[model samples]
Target: MKKSIEEIQKEIISEFSDLTDWEEKFQYLIELGEELPAYPEEKRTESYLVPGCQSRVWVCPSLENGELQFYADSDTALTKGLIAILIRVFSGHSPKEIANASLEFIDAIGLSKFLSISRRNGLSSMVNMLQNFAKNSGSEI
Candidate 1:
């Protein structure tokens, strides 16, 4: 079975708790990136291209029986994992919940401390894309 968001959050926290430095965080992100599944070339078209990322990203979210599902791909492995993290946080949530989610969750998890300025910006852009999709689709969150 797929892990729940709470479980994933716990795992992330546990995994990163021992790391006291930014370099370790970068290494951790790269390690997480290794776990992401591959994104097909066809999915990397213009419509899915996320603006503000140094790498190409494609995020497709759909609602099934009132639950949101997300599929994402990125040219960069680390970015792909970042996409996965975003999906874990926002997928399956109502649009309103996603839109209302505090950035504090990221900070609480120590993600912001480890992320570079560019990576943080990229993450914000990704979140915006997810929120926009949710709004357009009329999901509750």
Candidate 2:
């Protein structure tokens, strides 16, 4: 069976547990960003750009078999990794799953406290966008 969102969050928290230093955590985030699939150039447009971010970020969602799949990219590596984390948690899940998720892992992983105010805002924006996509399931976002 596929992992639940909470399971994924636990895994992420576990992954971050070993990296006690902020520098290490930031490096890990960059590495996570490196793992993201290359985003399509054509989809890099104003409509897909996520607002409230210090760096330019774009997230595209598609509904397939009732699951929401997300593709994203960001101008900065850190932001890219942030999006990657969100994608990992939200993608490949039903709209209701993504919409109802509490995403407490962010706080558990200490990411919320470590991020700058702007970065935190950006992260919040990304979460809002993902939930918005879920809320507007099957409709164009």
Candidate 3:
């Protein structure tokens, strides 16, 4: 069975808990970014661009077997890492699950505190976009 969003978040929090410093955490994020699947050039158009982000970010959502799968990428390494984290938690879940997700891991891991105000806003934008896609999809869980 697929893990719930909260379950996945807890696992991520546990993973971050091991890192002693922000530098180490940042390195971890870069490694996570490196794990993101290769994004298609065709999907990297204006339509997929996430608004309000400091860096260029694109996310494409597809519904398969009653779940929403997200494909995302960003121009900056840090931003790419951030998006990768979001995708790991949100993808392969029902729209209802995603729409209702609290995403407490962001705070629990001290990610928001480390990011710049602009980057924080960008993160917020990314979360909003994900939820909006879920809300708009009208798919049953």
Candidate 4:
């Protein structure tokens, strides 16, 4: 069976636990960004751009085999990693699962306290956009 979102969150938290320094954690996130699947240049149009982030972010959501799949990219590596975390949790999940997901893992990983206020707000915006997609998808399902 597939792991629950909570399990994924816990795993992330555990992974971050090994890196005590903020800089180490920061680098780890950037590494995670590097792991993101290459995003298509053709899809970077305004239609896919996520609003409310200081850095440009593009997200494409699609339904495949009854699961929601997300493809995303960001202008900045840090932001890309942030979105990567969200994608890791929500991708391959049903619309209901995505819509109901919580970002508590951010706190569990001690990330929320360290991010700049603007970054935090941007993260919230990212969540809102993805959740909007999930909610809309749920209605169609």
Best by TM-score: 3
Error of 2 at 19 (Å): 1.0
lDDT, model 4: 0.88
Q: What is candidate 4's lDDT per residue for 1-141, written digit by digit as tens?
A: 998888888889889999979999989988888899999999999999888888999999998987889999999999999999889988988888888888788898877899998898888888999888989985644
Which prediction has the highest lDDT against the true structure? 3
Please provide, for model 3 over 1-141, each residue's C-alpha lDDT reduced to its tens digit, 9 standing for 90 to 100. Answer: 879999999999999999999999999998999899999999999999999998999999998888999999999999999999999999999999999899999999998899899999999999999999999998463
lDDT of 1 by residue, 1-141 (tens): 856555666666776677887777667776766665666667778888889988778987778766677788887878887887778767776666666665445776666776789988898899899878877777354
CA lDDT of every candidate: 0.74, 0.93, 0.94, 0.88
Q: Report the number of clashing residue pairs per model.
A: 5, 0, 0, 0
**Residue pairs in collision within model 3:** none
* Candidate 3: segments with Cα more than 4 A from true spot: 139-141
Model 1 C-alpha lDDT versus the unseen true structure: 0.74
Candidate 2 local lDDT, 12-111, one digit each (tens): 9999999979899899999999999999999999999998888999999999998999999999999999999999999999998898899999999888
Q: State candidate 3's TM-score.
A: 0.97
Residue 12 accuracy (lDDT) in model 2: 93
